[model samples]
Target chain A: GIQVEQSPPDLILQEGANSTLRCNFSDSVNNLQWFHQNPWGQLINLFYIPSGTKQNGRLSATTVATERYSLLYISSSQTTDSGVYFCAVIPFQGGSEKLVFGKGMKLTVNP
Target chain B: DAGVTQSPTHLIKTRGQHVTLRCSPISGHKSVSWYQQVLGQGPQFIFQYYEKEERGRGNFPDRFSARQFPNYSSELNVNALLLGDSALYLCASSLSVGTDTQYFGPGTRLTVL
Candidate 1:
């Protein structure tokens, strides 16, 4: 079983601010992704970066697999971005292919 | 295209009862997985099905079960539900099994009394 840990469990920022969320895994992962759980409880995929960096709009993510850590960056935050940001990962071995999710970073962007 | 769709967005049941939650994956998807997310917690995996076969299961109890249909749709059935069973049950679908990126439905909010 793999263990996932997310930092800044709770975060609050003013609109237009930037923040960085980090996720550290206990083992190597073949796949890693960042998800946004909106207010409606729908989990939206943010980034699917197993390694290197990816940017989508104002959101970006980078995964350093060798270091067993990943980061999600939210730039120019908006009210709509307020929600729980989660990091999920699957190990290289196909033990279950089930995602091991971190507790999540609750982000609140004040308008 | 339609994303993952779940039936009965909300539900309420009593303890010791049986309940079933349904999920229809996106078209052309062959893998469906079930997860339970409690209040203030992240989603926990329950089961994973691919090509109408059980591919993997989580650390949940035997009372929890699920199956995938030929069309890749899936159902999660819980027998002898407990108060602890009250949680938002989420169904996710991916192009294939063992993929980390998943598209999740809105989820069914189950409240047990």
Candidate 2:
């Protein structure tokens, strides 16, 4: 089994500030995804970066598969960003394609 | 296009009771996976079904089971539920079985008494 660990389990920032979340896994992965869990418990897809870097609006993510880690960056955050951010990966082991998720990082953006 | 959809947004049950949760995947998607997330914890994988067949299962007990239908819809059943079973059950669907992005539903909040 693979292990996923997220850093800075709890984060609080001002509405206009920027932040970065990190995720480290114990094994090689074939797929990696970042999600924003809203207060209503909806897992909103943020990015699907197995490797390399990608950006969407004020959010961007970079994954260094060789290093078994990934980073998610939020620029000029908003109040709506107050929620839990999760990183999940599908390890390249066995025949199973199940995603092993990190404990998640709780982000609080105060206006 | 509609994303993954789950039924009974919330549920309450007693210990030893049996419960079933339903999910319909996005159109053209043939893989459905189930995950359980406890309070203050990350979501844990339960089962993965592809093409109406069981492809992968997590470390959950035998009380947890799931099946996918011909239409790619899925049902997750838990027998003799325990208090520990109370959590948010999420259903995710991907276009294929391996190395694809999984889109999740809003999830069903289950409470066991």
Candidate 3:
């Protein structure tokens, strides 16, 4: 089984500010994804990066498999970005491929 | 195409009662998985089904069970619910059982009283 740890459990940022979140996994993972859980409880997929770097508008993520860590960066953050960001990994343990989620980083972007 | 869908956005149950939750995965997806999200915590894996077979089970009690249908839809059954079982149940559909990305449903809020 793989253990995932997300840093900066709580983050508060002013609108238009920038922040970065980090995730570290205990073992090699076959898959990694970032999700944003909105205030309304809707889970939205942000990125599916197993390795390398990817950018989607104001948000971008980079996963370094060898380092067993991933980083998510938010640029010019908006109030709407206030929510929990989850980092999930699948280590393919027992051939299940079940995703193990970290507690997540709670971000509050105040306007 | 439609994303994953779940039935009965919310539910209320009492101790010693049995309840069934349903999920419809996104079109063209073949893997369905369930997770439980307690308040202020991340979702924990429950069960995963691929190709109508049980692929994985979480650390949940034996009272919790689930099965996948022929059409890739799935149902989760919890028998003799306990108050601690109250939480949000989320269903996710993946393009495959291994490394594909997973999309989740809005989830069903279950309140076990």
Candidate 4:
């Protein structure tokens, strides 16, 4: 089983501030994604970056497969951005495609 | 296009009872997976079905089961549910079985007493 660890278990910031969240996995991954669990308990896909860099609006993500780590950046954060950010991945091993999710980083953006 | 949809947004049951949750995946998506999200914890994989076949399963007990229909819709059934079975059940659909992006539904909150 692959272990996923997220840094900064909890974060609080003022609106418009920027923050970085990191995810470290214990194994190589062929599928990696970032998700946002909103207040309503809906899991929203943020980024599906297995490698390289991708940006969506004020949010961006970068994954280094070799290092087995990924970073999610939120710029100009808004009150709506307050949610649990999670990193999920499937190991590159054969016949193993189950997505293992990290415990998540809880972020609170105050208006 | 409509995203993944789940039925009975909320449900309440008692221990030793059985409950079934339904999910309709996005159009053209043939893979449906189920996950359980306990309070204060991340979602845990339960089962993955592709082309109406069981592709993968997690560490859940035998009491948990799921099946995919011809239309790619899915149902998760739990038998002899225990108090620990109380959690949010989420269904996700992907274009293909493995290594594809999965779009999740709003999830059904199950309360087992």
Candidate 5:
């Protein structure tokens, strides 16, 4: 079994500020994804970066598989960005392909 | 083009009762997985089904079971539920098994009394 740990379990920022969230896994992974859980409990896909870096609009993510960590960055955050962010990964195990998740980081963006 | 969809947004049942939750994957997706998320914690994997066959299972007990249909939809059943079973059940779907990005649906909130 692999372990996923997220940093800065709680964060608060003013609207238009920037923030970064980090996730560290205990084992090698074949797939990694970031999600934004809205107040309604919907897990919205943010990025699917197993390695390397990717960006979508004001959001970007970089994963260093060799280092077993990843980072998600949000710039010029909006009040609507207030929610929980999660990082999930599929470890390179024998026959299982389950996505293990980190405890998550709660972000509050005040307008 | 639609994302994963789940049925019965919320449910409440007494201990020892049985419950079933349904999920429909995105069009053309062939893998579906189930997870349970307790309050203030991350989601835990329960089961993974691909092309109507069980591919992987988590640390949950036999009380939890799931099956996939020919159409790639899925249903998760919990038997003789306990108070600890109360949590948010999530359904995720991907284009295929291994290494694919899994998109999740709005989870079903279950409360066992």
Candidate 6:
């Protein structure tokens, strides 16, 4: 079983500010993904990055497989970005794809 | 194209009763997985089915079971429910069984009385 830990369990940022979130996993993972769970309980997939770095508009993510950690960057945050961000990982065991989710980083962007 | 669709947005059941939740995966998706999300916690994996066969299961008790159909649709069955079993049941579908991104449905909110 793999353990995923998310840092800054809670965060508050100004609308135009920037923030970074981190996720550390205990073991090697076959896959890693970032999800945004809005206040309405909708889980939206943000990125599916197992290695390397990816950017989607104002948000970006980088995963260093060797270090077993990932970082999510949000630049010029907006109020709509206020929600819980979660990072999920699948361990490299028998091709198991069951995601081990971290507690999540709760972000609040205020106007 | 439709994403994963779940039946009955919400459900209420009594203790010792049986409840069944249904899920229809996205078109062309061959993998279906079930999870339970409790308040203030992340979704916990329950079962994973691929090509109509059980591929993996979580730490949940045997009272919780599921199966996939030939068309890749799935159903989750929980017997002898308890108050602790009340949570949001989420069904997710991926392109394949392993190491793929899962698209989740709106989920079925179940409350056991």
**C-alpha lDDT of residue B75 in model 5:** 99
lDDT of each: 0.93, 0.96, 0.94, 0.95, 0.96, 0.92
* Predictions: Cα RMSD each: 0.9, 0.7, 0.9, 0.6, 0.8, 1.0
The TM-score obtained by model 1 is: 0.98
TM-score of chain B of 3: 0.98
Off by over 4 Å in 3: A92-94
Q: Please give, for residues B1-113, the per-residue lDDT of candidate 2 as tens digits.
A: 99899999999999999999999999999999999999999999999999999999999999998999999999999999999999999999999977999999999999999
lDDT value, candidate 3, whole model: 0.94
User: What TM-score against the true fold does each predicted structure earn?
Assistant: 0.98, 0.98, 0.98, 0.99, 0.98, 0.97
- Residue-wise lDDT of candidate 1 within A34-54, one digit each (tens)? 999998899999998999999
Model 1's DockQ score: 0.80
Screening candidate 1 with a backbone cut-off below 3 angstroms (N, C-alpha, C), the clashing residue pairs are none
lDDT (Cα, tens digit) per residue for candidate 6, span B23-73 = 999999999999998988888999999999898899999999999999999
The list of candidate 1 runs beyond 4 A from truth reads none
Model 3 clashing residue pairs (backbone): none
Which candidate ranks first by DockQ, i.e. highest?
5
Q: How well is each residue in B31-80 modelled by candidate 4, as lDDT tens digits?
A: 99999999999999999999999999999999999999999999999999
Q: Could you give the candidate ranking by DockQ, starting with the highest?
A: 5, 2, 4, 1, 3, 6
Off by over 4 Å in 2: none
Candidate 6 regions with alpha-carbon error over 4 angstroms: none
The DockQ values of the predictions, listed in order, are: 0.80, 0.89, 0.79, 0.81, 0.90, 0.69
Q: Which tens-of-lDDT digit does each residue in A42-63 have in candidate 3?
A: 6899999989999999999999
Q: Positional deviation of B3 in candidate 6, in angstroms? A: 1.0
lDDT of 2 by residue, A1-111 (tens): 899999889999999999999999999999999999999999999999999999999999999999999999999999999999999999987696998899999999998
lDDT of 6 at B18: 99
Candidate 6 per-residue C-alpha lDDT over A57-96 given as tens digits, one digit per residue, 9 for 90 to 100: 9999999999999999999999999999999999987857
